[model samples]
Each structure stands twice: as C-alpha cells, then as structure tokens.
Target: MKACLNRTIAAAGLAALLVSGTLPPASAADPGWHTSSSLIGTSKYGDDFKRYDYVNPNAPKGGTLNTTTAGTFDSFNPYIVQGNPAAGFAGFGGGLLYDTLMEQSVDEGSVSHPLVAEAYKYPDDFSSATYRLDPRAKWHDGKPITVEDVIWSFTVLKANSPLYNKYYANVTEAVATGEREVTFRFDQKGNRELPKIMGDLVVLPKHWWEGTDANGKKRDIGRPTQEPPLGSAAYKISSFKAGTEIVWERVPDYWGAQLPVKIGRENFDKRRFTYFLDDNAAWQAFGKGGFQDFRAESSAKRWATEYNFPAIQAGDVTKSEYPTTSGQPMQAYVMNTRRPLFADPRVRKAITMAFDFETMNRTLFYGSYTRTDSYFEGGELASSGIPQGKELEILEPFRDKLPPELFTQEFKLPVYDTPQAGRENLRAAVQMFKEAGWVNRGGRLANEKTGEQFRIEFLGSDPTDERVATPYIDSLRRLGIDATLRIIDESQYINRTRSFDFDMLALSSFAQSQSPGNEQRDFFSSKAADTPGSRNLAGINNPVVDALVDRVIFATDRDDLIAATHALDRVLLWNYYMVPQWHLGKVRAAYWNKFGIPEKQPGYIGVDIDSWWIDKDKEAALAAKYKGVN
Candidate 1:
C-alpha cells in the first residue's frame, strides 16, 4: 500500500502534518494524502486521534486463533481463479498476511482511518487520486516497499483479476508520479466512492513474485501455488498443508504496529484455519475440541437442535446472538435467464411460486428466517408500497419497459402456509406459465406449441444445501416440471456459474453497504451479464437494469442514492428475476471461554474478532478442565 511510513520520519505524528486539515498538495486534480470524511468533507476522526474506540489499546497479544470452515483449498494464492483459497487471509487476522492502503474503522460505516498511506486525498472533482507513502514500510524479505510495487500491483491485478478489472473499470491510468507517490487517473469524474474503493485494493509484492523460488523456479501471480507467498502484514505464513490447514505467526516487530490505526488490533500470536469438505465433520471437530475457537452456525435446524453438546453443557463454550443492523443479503435460487428455458420472466415467476417458504421455515428451518422481499432487504433503500417522488421520477422514463405492477403493487412473496394457500399460488403460477406457452397436458408440463417437457436443474457445491433445494425440487415436480439437483465440486461449480452454463443455482450476493455504488454493476448490469466471473448469476441484460445501476452508482447525495436504489430494487422485484429467500436479524456465534474481547463491539460488524486476545489464565484453566474430557 505504501513505499514507506509517512509518519515514521521526524514528524512522528499525523497531527503535526494535518494541523489545519490539509494534506500536502500535489496538484489541483490529484491531491496528496489528506484527512477527509467524504469527497468534500473532513474525517470523523481528528488528526490527533490515536486508535479506534472499538478496540482495547491495552489488549494482550499471544496464543493462536483457530478457525473451522467447510471446504478444501487447493492453493494459497487468493488473487487467481486457478484454485480455492483458504479463509482468515486478512483483517482481524492479517486476512493474517497482506495490508491495504487504508484501514476502515470498525465502528463507523462512512469513516476511514489511514494506515500505510499516512494520508490520502482526491480533488474537488475526484478525477484522480494521489497517495503519500510512509517511508518505513518493508516486505517480508526486509526489502523496502516502493512506488514501483504499487503501480505494478495495480497493473497486474487489473489485468488478471476479474473483480478488480470490473471494479476499477473507470480508472484508466496508474503511474508513479514521484518516489513515494502513485497517481490513479480516472476517465470519468463525479464517482464519489472511487477513491474509497481504491483504498480497498490489496497491494501485492512485485519483487518476491518476480523472483525465483527456493528451487530456482520463477513465481507467477496467475497460477496457484502451495508455497506461502511473502507478506509484510502483522502475520506471515508459518506452515500449511494444502487442502488441510494454514497457520500464520504474528510478527513481533511488525512495521505498522505502532501506527495509529493498528494500535490495539491483530492481538493473536498465531491464527490457524482448518478446512473440512464436510460441514458435519467440521462440527464434530469443534465439539471434540479439535479446533478450540469460534463457530458461526448457518443452519437453523442445526442451531436449534444441536446446541446441547458436551462442551456447551460443561460451560466452557459461550453462546451469543446479536441483532445486527447490517443489510440482509439477497440469497435465492438464481434463475439463469441466459438459458432458453428461463428466457421468459413468467417461467421464473412460476418457479418462485413453487417454493413454500412458510412450510420450510416451520418444518425445516425451525421458524428461524423471515421472508426476504427486496434486493436491498432489511434496509432503508428497499422499495416499499408504490413508487413516488424522486424515485418515481428516475423510473418514469422506463415506465413503458417495466412491469405495470411497479406502479400499482407492493412486491410480495406468496404465502403457502396451508394446503389451500399452496393450491391458490399454484393456480396463479399455472396461469402465468400458460401465457408463456407452457400448459399442462396429460399431467406433464410442456410447451403448448412444441410439446417439449419442461425440465429444471439446480447446480450446487454444498450437499448440505440439499435440505432446502430437494424440497423445492419436489414442489416443482408436483407442477409437472422435471427438476433435479446436480451437486458438483467447488471448482466446477465456480467455473460453470462464471460461464453461465447452469440453468438454476443458489447464490447469496454480498449485502449492500450504507452507500451502494459501482459493485451494483457486477451484480445486475447488462455489461457484466456476458463477463465471466461476474456476480450477475441470473445473466441480467436489460437496458433498464443497466441505467438504474448507473444511477445508483452516480448518485450525488444520500437522498439521491436511496431514491435510485429503491427504483432499482422495485424494477428487479416486479420482474421476478429470482426467488427471494429469507433472512435472520441476529448472527449466532459460539466461542470457547479462553479469549478476552472488548465490551463494546463494532456497531456494523457485530463481531470484531480483531479486538480479541487470548486470556492466558483462562487458556490454562481450559486445558486443565478438558484435558481428558474429549
């Protein structure tokens, strides 16, 4: 993220440099690192602020943080698409190995505290951004980081990483403007979030990547490798067995440890991630103390019935459920509109009706989820009732191209709690299918003109998901449509989904932040429909959707952004692009009692694992308590 620590020199403090709220000026268009809140405002934290209030500055640092996850990793590389990468790779842990240009504060959504950059700033128009580096930053091999590494990292990542290529599409140039400064010039202006998004870029070490390995084999960023790559973060890869586990050891003298943003974080001596292909196996391991740390339960049935395990009853494990304010993700069975069978919105709508969320929530999920009704579910931006005011003004031009119901109806999922309710919903679905050239003949659904029987297939990687998909498939069968679940491995699933090769698949898109921006393009824009690895799993290609996504990204203020996002959500729902799933208000977390954490957690994050450190006395007590109990 930086060639060196800017505050590492004689200035020694940010307050001395930004006493009047201005960073060193570079040019009119490209300002050097500066303290800021918005594109045109001051940051929430003053220049003299030491560390985040959410973290315990006096927290002790020692002991390992263990993680349990489902899946197998084939490579240690996180940038490439060649293999599955392991978890616990960044913040809270080192993500436990790489650092970004800026560190976003855990307590606030809109504010950011500088880390490697010392300070960063853009112009009034946000046409370009310039970063002034801290001079003390270094790579794991003891080599000083340089401006060349920043520029090279941007170039290679934009060229090879699909996500970055799309996310930074507007940024047209990246060149070293000075020894410790690099400028990223954008082709388009007025994108308020671009500068903030740029700070999220993960900087890779160009020197180690281009140099030869221990056996004289040159490293390639495009390929996957078992060899742990060099990093300058607080942790480095200590050891790993590919597909099994990866361990990172904390660096005692980490370069940015004393930086204002990192004062009380990364408190673990080591962090270990253990992977299991089976979810049940992973649960078993946690129960037997194979990995003694934390677990977040995803399945409602499992959480309701499986909490009475020995360790929990022994009072060694603590359970917590937090009511979150985070946006609920739009999780659903994405109907691939690129495929011919799903080309008609009517067919997709009919398939959505076949799902009985009420029954599943009651019988299968232990009534743990609430029905999701919007792309921006559980948030202020979610459209409700009918369109009006500024939002309606944004949608008026496309009124002819959208569903008439967008103006008259509130989008709602069908209720199928009773047999009669299910029948009524099915009847409505049948009418829509009839209009789309599908009809029931001799108890089998088929195209009325072509006499072709309808068949639907679900592509999945996790077998445990079958609990939900299989019942939906059975419901689809009752409607005379032949549907089946096709479970594949993680790699195959990723490749197929990326290429739009499957008809239907389960996907949970990332929840939107308070300010929704460019990422919406990758999720629903027409351009991303054809781009492989894009999040537009439904292959959305409507011109209207594209314009709405742009409007959301280019929104000028909070009101404008909310109105545009509401319009976008309304249009997507009325079209029935995918069946909406369910959401939970709280995150269920369980952890061993040997760790000490802050009393107040980050409001947005719910759980701040970074602020936790091992309690030495508790760890010793746990070892003595459970020594032969497993």
Candidate 2:
C-alpha cells in the first residue's frame, strides 16, 4: 500500500464482461463515480482512453521471458508469512496469480484504473467506498467474479497476512451491497487514500481456496502450500520443479486480454523463473545462456566491470540505464532495536557511523552510486536545509520528545575526504558508544554495568553482500567490537528477519513512493514494531515518529503531505535507526537484444517488462548467432 503505483507490475486480471445492465446507475444523491482515481491530482486518462502510452498496443505476444531469482522457494502462496513464496506469485505489485480490484498506471504517480471493478464511488467525506464489479469478470474456471469473492478476499487477506492486516487496519468492514458490488467502510472519515487503496484489494477465488485439493485435504488459507493456487490473471503456473524452477504459461483466452488497461501488457507467452543459490551462480547462468534472458543488475561493481562478456562484444546483448521518476528506495544497513545491543539511539548511531559509504562508493562501487541521505531519497519529499515554515510547524510540538539537534542542525551523515578523517569518525563513534554505557575493556567494547561484550552479527542472504559487509565488519573490529557477518540461505534469512532475530541486517531496502500514506504506519509505527514480519525492520517505536506518520497519512493536500513527510524524514534520520546506504537514480539493466522496448518509457516506473515484447527478427538473429554455442 506504499502507493500501489510503485509496484513493478500491475497484476493484470479482468474478464470481458457485458457492457450493459451490470449495476444500477448512480443515484442523484450519490457523489460522482469514477472509473479511475488519483491521490495527488486528477487522473491522466479519462474513461475513453485506450492503452497506456508506454505500451505497444500492437505488440505480438508469443515468446518466453526467462528470468532468475537468487533463492529457493518452498511455497507457491505468497499471501502467508510462514514460507518463502516463489517469485512472481505476489509482490508489492499484484502477483501473476491474482489481480487487484484496480490496476495502477506505470506512467502516472498514484493513479489507478479499474480492473475487477469497473467504477467506484465515495462520498465527499470518504468514510466509505463502493465498487461496482464488471459483470463479465469471471474466474479461469468460468465462474462469475462476485461480491462474495471480493468480501471474502478482503477478510481472509487481512486475517492471514500481517502486511495486509496493517495495510487495511482502518477498513472496518467489507460487505456486499449489490449482486456485483461490494462496499468497504472505514473506521474514520477524511482519509482520502482509503478509497484509493481499497482499489488495491487482490480478490481471491473464494471457492477455489475453500474447496478441497486433489489430495482431499481441507485447504488452509493460513498455511503454506505448493499446490499452485487457482488464478484469474493473465498467466498461471504451468509447471514447477519444487525449489529450482517455475514456469507460467500465458492464458491464450485470458478474459482481460482485450481490456484497454491490459491491451499491450503481459506480452510474453511464457514466463519462467529459475532459482540460483547466489548472485555468482545466477550471473554464470546468464553468461552461459541459461534461462535468464534479462537482468536488472543491482551491483555497481558488476555493472562497471562484468559486462564485457563475449555476448556484449558480439552485439548479442545490450546494457542501458533508464531514468526513473519514482521515489528512490532507501537501501540501508538496518539495525534491529529490539536487541539490547542496539537499544540505545547513541549505540545505533555509533554503529551507523562505522559505515564508510564514501570509501565504499569509490573503491567497491566504482563511483556509480550516490550516497542516500534521506529516507525519501531522490525525491522532493526529502527534508533538507533545516526545516522551516510548514515543516517546522509540524515538528515544533514534538521538539521536547525529539533530539535537540533535529530542530537546530541540518541532519547529514559525516563525510570523510581522507583516511584520517574516516579514522576520526570511528574514534567519535567509540566515544558515542562509551556515553551509551559501553566501555573499552582489554580492547573489547563492553557494557559498563553488565560487563557484556558488544558482539554484532550482520545477517545477509546474498553472498554478494559480503563485498560491502566485509569492510564494515573490519571497521567494527578496529573499534574492538566483536562484529561478524553471517551469510545464510534465503530461507533461513527470511525466517530470522521475520522473528526479529538478527542483530543487524547487512542490507534491507524500503521502497518509497511520491505520496506516502497508510503504508507509513506499517513501516514506522510502534504497533508495527511489535508486529512480526512487518516492514519496521529496525523496530522503530518512537512516539514522535508515530505522530509524524499520522500527520503524513492524514494530510489533506499535496503541499501539506510533502511538509509532513519532510518532518517525518527529519525525525527518522535524527533517530539513527539505520545506516543510510546508496542508490542509483536510474535503473541499470542488461538483456539479450531480442526484445523490443517501448518507444516511450514511463517516467515513474522506468522499465516495465510487461510492456516489452520479443522481437521475432532480433530473436532469430540471436538464435542464429549463438547456434551450437551452448
């Protein structure tokens, strides 16, 4: 719910429904209904608009899109927190198996178009919202998508997933209002985002979930399963090899294929995801012409030095950077405050100060990355130059509870131009730890009162993370802190992070959006800190942060929202919950030169793979060039 528009793929689902007699016309007493909604401003497209400008409406859809995910998957279900779900099942964006009530537009910020529901209406106060489902919307099994399915999905998702529970916490109830209409009533009014977020509801097939499986076992929605759940989306699981691979076959007769919103999207006839143990294995597979056809390279080191393979030299592959207008993701070394070792802000700040990002950028990243200073990095919402006016007014009341420097000083990470300066920063960090009841005893930093050694274990799932973690761990060792890096498998990593068992995460990313709303609660609220599997990985529980989160969520206008966000960013930074990392403003991707990209790339989403199609001519040329090579 962190602005559904931030999702990489809008779960494409909807059926060709009858145009006439779906529901009764809106009453004169009712507010004007809309086929689309926007959080920041008026929607870019009207009701009669065709496909998105970023997609090729005439794109031919009959090629396999092979991708890779670094990790094994135990369950096909992504809704539950109990297991590692296969990639593409579900994510920030809608999943390949399920479709949301509304599909987000990649080209726009916080704008959503109708999918399952044709139109939605809400009063001026926005206490509640009513959605009119498309009459022709049908499940893959040919059953009509009903109000029952909608209501059941909302109830079950909230009950099973902590993420969904926190996301829809304000929505009190979902009840059927008509044959194909369901209304979601909120606990309070004036939350304009509630109605819009309700559009993100991913409707499940109630009958399929409730029915017994082939083994005649009662299906449990709360449990993990590998049975490949029923789906209404454009693709379905065609085959899967336990933890190694999964393939989704495009539905030749997908009901929504002709829908305006989906006309040129989901172009691939087959989508296959092959799993690898680590980044090296995945990269090797790509070099060997394995299942991977495209990759969005995340490691700057690799992008700078590893793209000189024979394929690149032969012009069989292309690497490019796409500019994005989306809010930059705050990737950081997250310290779990639940642990006694990081309980003190001074201690956390001390730990953060050890991360020499300036040196890392130059040595490891090849100067390809920019240091991230703000939680809302690369965006207008980032607080800067000492808050004043509206932002200052929002933070003034909480001055007594916040760090005094927050109001006086412009918050920034210490920059070091020389090795001596970096060493001085480390000395200062040690002093901070000393002030927080830690003392150096025989070269080991220990708690003064308890005589406990400060031992920090940085948990990571990817082996590639060691390139960054190794130096930071060495830095901590120089300070006489017993720090180590634990690189575990993906499964163990997921399980450990869920229970807040890690001392600090080597790397964790929080994706932000232009409009920060209800999702902020799940990310920074005290309640979320206590909720296992919540996005509040740092265990942020400050009342000032809680209050600021609410202010951002309830801001009535765009200007007010930005001001509130600036205040929130300021407070979170001053708290030193995590070590700010770096980000690339543009997306760096390398792929075989067999796909045709759109003429106009969306500014907000940058590269939408769903809009790209296999160019038959290019693919044939590549096949001829690599004939017998593999």
Candidate 3:
C-alpha cells in the first residue's frame, strides 16, 4: 500500500542545471538556494511564477463540500497508527488540518513549491538541506512557526510512526541553524532525492501539542485524541460525532491564504466527511442528494448499472471518467510470506495460476479494467520483454539466486480464454503443487509430509471485495483446497493487517509515483516487513530485494532510476508474492452540477477538488429542482 505521506519531487533537475552552466557548482561550503524543488527535471515554476496553471485564481469560494468515506474513525490524529484517523485529517499535501514545508504540484510528477518554508538550500552532494521558514507562517493561535517546531515534528514522527520511520531513515538529524532556519542532515551523501523529499515533512505545532488541553490534561503526540489539534493550514476541525461524521471549517484569516501555492486552492467554506459502514450505504446516501456531494466510483458493477437515479437522469448530477497521467497502482491479493502456508514461492505461484481474471473481468467488472502486469504499471519504468543493458547488469550478480526463467522469458500472467484453457492451467497448477510436496489425496489437497489440508482464507473489509473473492474462492476449491472469504469490520481489519495476522488480503494496493524512491523501501524492504503498521503487507525479506531498493533510492539520474526500478520489478514479479488484479486508467466520479471546475484539470492527480468553486446560479437551479420534486 502507498504511504499516506508519500509525495514526489525531482532530483535530476539539479544535475541538468549544473551541466547547462546556468548556475555555478554548489558544495557544502557554498549551497544553492531555491524556492522550488524537483526530482526528475527542472521545476516548471520558477521564483517569479505565481499560481499553478491548473487552478483558477479568480474563482469565488463560499460553498460547502460534502463527501463520504466507507469506514469510521476514532481519532483526529493521522500521524500515528494507534487508531483510525478521520478522513481529511491528513494525507498528501497535508490534508485539511496541517500544512507541510512545501506544497506538491498536482500537474507535475516530481515537483513541489514552498508553502511554510519561503526558500530552501542544498549542497551539490545533497548531504544536508536547510529551509528558511516564511515569517508570515503562523499557527491558529497567532504564534510564528519556529525552527524548533520543525525539528520537534520530524523527531517525534520518525520515532513514533513506522511509516515515517521507514521513510525518513536516511535523514539523520534536524538542527536549528538560524532564528527561522532549520537544517536536516542526511546519513550519507550523493542521494539527490533526500533534499527534495524533506519538503514533504508536515510541520506540527510544538507549543500546542506539548501544552495542556481544556481539561488541564497534558496532550500526548503518541496517543489518540478527539480534541482537534492546532493547525497552520487553511482549515481546522470544527466539529465531529465520533465515528459518524467530521466537519472542517476554513480559516477566515488563514496565514498563508495569499501565498502563491494557496492562491486558488481550499475554495470551500466548509468540508464535511460523513462516515458509513460500507460502500453500498455510502452509494445510497450519495444518490439521495444533500447527504453527499461527490462520489469516486470504485465498483465497476455499480458504475455500469446503477447510475439511473433521478438526479443523473435530470442532468442535476454529472458522471464522467477523468483521465490521469499518474502511474497505475498495483492492486492485488497479497499473500503473507511470514505465514507458514505461503512460505514457498512455488506454492504462491500455483495459487496465483488458479485466478481467472479474464472471466472475472467479463462477468463481474463489465470489462472496465486492464490486467496489471508489473508493480509499476502504466509507467515507463515497468519492465517489458526481457531484461537488457542496465537492468541486466544489475541482476547479473544475483543470477544464481534468482529464477533462470526470469532472465530468458518475459513475465506474463496465465490467460484462460476458453474453458478448456482454464482446465489446462488448473492441471498445470496441481502438478506444480505436487512438485512442492502437495497432492490431492482422497479429493483433498494436503501436504505429503504433515498431511495438513491446504486451507486459505481471504480477508476483506469491503463488501465489494467479497464479491470478487467469492468467485476466486470457488476456483480455489476446485483444486481440493479449503478456501474461504471472511468479511470483517473496518476497525478489526486495520488492526489485523497491521499486525500481519491474516493469511491473505482480498485487496492490497501499492500506489507508485513517476519518480520512485524511499517509499519503495517501505513497500518491499526487509526492515519494513518486520515493522508493524508498515506498508509491506507481503512480508518480503529477500536480501536481493533490499539491495535493489537501495539502487532505486540512490539512483543518480532519471534513466538510472528507471533501469533500477525495472530490475526490481522483474525480481518482484518472478517471486509471485501477490496475485495481480486489474486497474482503470481513468477515475470514474459522479458529483452534483452545482460546482464549477477549472478549464484545465491536473494531469497527474486528475480532479483537483480544492481548485473547484461553487456556481451560485447552478446551486440555485439544483435547489429549485429538488424542491419541485419534493
């Protein structure tokens, strides 16, 4: 799964700038300072650039945005894994409650502009990075944001959250170099991405968190709390009803409201997220207007057949697919290797062969998705055909350790076009299982040594996943395997998955960026596998994978990063750690026609809800239509 805090930035741009002789070579003694950063190429926006091209600076803002989430939340804090965090509390670009050091550009893959920090400087070697906080930056209480707060936030996050621990592992220390300046030092040099990623740090208020609450009890950063924390962002938590709902009110005098990055964003006066027990309930609420304003459709079955509502028929609602330039996430049924039953790669491969994605797509998905083939699908970094050149060189040393077929053949999932072909694949799967010391004895597949039945359970929190798992389970049973699907509550699911307590997850996704880096470690590294609450759900512990992850992280240029990622992807595919599912290239969404969207949408993130404004005339018309119907 993708880390909630993950954001992309460019590193190759610095190298290109040095090569072009546009700037003098920088070193520790003479660092170059800039207002923006990028990891793949030069930042599209320069020092004089105003707002992003995708936003409308003139758009008026005053309406409320009502959205719904499928699960309940118990805590306001999203930084720690102690409790389920409320939706919109925190995510990419600091969500609604907090502002990060920099704001990510939705249209660019690997670029970000200053938000809290006015300017930043880094050496040629990227050993350390320093940021000068904007003097105008302030918390809700009107106190200026300090370097001490930046240092404290980084120190506390890295020590408490496993996700942050793995992400900032390379960052050694944060020190106050000046009254408004803080520097983050790295453990090693030559990592161009480190300086850029530091821009993603969500700055927390040191004074408020450490101070006492209204009850006179000291607040703890590690514990879960319902009391809304202080924030520097455009919105603050105004009200909540435990697991039922949460509402955010935009700050009238938000300190950075006029900043370049915030000019045309956070357009809504209020943002409310209503919680439902499941997707079906949420869908019903969305159809009954006023309960929900926007819905991002995830189920193909529902999107294909269930949009005949009155609002949609009357043109009061708009349903459309928005194309995106973002990388296709790896959505799959993840098998936990830490479990004894899935310890062998051969057994995992046999199990994967039983899944008939072609049939599933035709019947259940309405042919809306494409079969995923790589960990980094829909991106140029995905490995295709056979390994050659740099990718081959990276894998040469591990030739004896890896599967030989991986080197000779292109990796592709088994396809079952006909019933006969399906049967043939099943037979092949049984034979492979037999070679791995499993056999069908008296019509039940059991281990030859232990005589234990090959039982597996697919766990899921969503009803939609259960629909897909039911068919897959039937296929597994045909092989004489005891397979079952278990649908649990959202809270229990989170607790169980974090502790690696499940045999298999019905759905686990690994979201990728155009410029992959440190986040790869949390997804595939051995250290992450051992860390509770980390994104490494499969528990991959291969040393070769660890080495390859480093290669991707420490890659010096864009080409080197792509080649390294290709090598890593090939190795991961050959391991059969998970059964690849399918993905859609476009985001399917339905929303009321009362909002006005910008002429251009962000290419990388698709729809930018923050850039949208309420159209008064349309809102009035929609209200009149609903009144007439009533």
Candidate closest to the true structure, highest TM-score: 3
Write the residue-wise lDDT of candidate 3 on 106-187 in tens digits. 7777777889998888887778889999999999989999999999999999988787787789999999999999999999
Task: State the lDDT of candidate 1 residue by residue for 64-175, as single tens digits.
Answer: 8887666677776766545666665521113557777666555555455565566666787777787767788877778877788888888887777666676778889888
* Off by more than 4 A, model 2: 1-30, 91-93, 627-630
Kindly give the stretch of ten consecutive residues in candidate 2 with the minimal lDDT sum: 13-22
Question: Given candidate 3, what's the lDDT at residue 209?
Answer: 94
TM-score per candidate, chains pooled: 0.91, 0.94, 0.94
**Mind giving the per-residue lDDT tens digits that candidate 2 earns over 453-555?**
8999998877776887898899899888999999998778888888888888887777776777887887899999998878888899889899998888777
- Displacement of the residue 299 alpha carbon in candidate 1, Å: 1.4
Q: Rank the candidates by lDDT, best first.
A: 3, 2, 1
Best by lDDT: 3
In model 1, what lDDT does residue 67 have? 79
Model 2 / residue 478 / CA error / Å: 1.6
What's every prediction's RMSD, in angstroms? Answer: 6.9, 5.0, 4.4
Q: Looking at candidate 3, what is the lDDT of residue 140?
A: 93
By TM-score, the candidates rank as: 3, 2, 1
